[model samples]
Target: MSKIIFVNLPVSDLNASMAFYEALGFENNPQFTDDTAACMVWSEAIFVMLLTHDKWKTFTNRPISPITTSEVMLCLSCESREIVDELNDTAEENGGTADINPKQDHGFMYNRNLADLDGHVWEMMWMDPAAMTN
Candidate 1:
């Protein structure tokens, strides 16, 4: 059984995609590095498998979702409000856009949205562990 969770995304450019994710503090798994796909490690067990459009097509015959028309949004949790801002800023510096309104800071949790160069939406957020129960 596979122990790691892989979230695959279709990308237009491998280098740009890698750089974008790296700016968000992800490390590339060299073992899986290749011309068509890259394994990005977010945590020990969490990863994002980014594939070029051509490579992604090999896995499914179904139509790929256009970022604007797609129904999927990738959500990632951070350690704190500052982390949320840090990730978003990195994305922006790497050619992504802050496609949504700013965070709704509720003291215990903070959240915001960012759209990558491919227009894929990612939720950048932080939730206080201490406040989760109260």
Candidate 2:
């Protein structure tokens, strides 16, 4: 079996976070969901557990970083620039805020950032396979 488990970062609002991710097209896995955490299935092998901060802390002793002071940004890939833009748009529509970084067009790759409810940054990107070839 594949060692497949994506980290579930804590958020203040589980319902809002679930809605936010749902807007981006990920389906909810009822099998792993409860009032405090929702298992969001990105694909067969990839999943995101949107947990309430209080419930999430049961697994760790580390301090939860405020979104404004967070240093790490999570990056996700898209198939095309249009898809990148679409996700960002949907995120905002669902209450996610945009990152300060401007959209980048490297000819082969396009990228942008959006900060979710708890201030976690998520980078949305697209890369052209043809341009990746030498």
Best model per lDDT:
1
Error of 1 at 77 (Å): 1.4
**Candidate 1 local Cα displacement, residue 100, angstroms:** 2.7
Residue 108, candidate 1: Cα error in Å is 0.9
Expressed as tens digits, the lDDT of each residue in 27-88 for candidate 1 is 99999989999999999878989999999999998777876764677888988788898888
| Top candidate (TM-score) | 2
Per-residue CA lDDT of model 2 for 1-134, tens digit only, reads 97876768898988989889988988999999999899998777779898887888898889888777877777888888888888888878888876446888889888999888788888898988788757
- In model 1, which runs have C-alpha deviations exceeding 4 angstroms? 99-102, 132-134
lDDT against the true structure, each candidate? 0.85, 0.84
* Candidate 1, backbone clash total: 0
Over the full model, what C-alpha lDDT does candidate 2 score relative to the true structure?
0.84
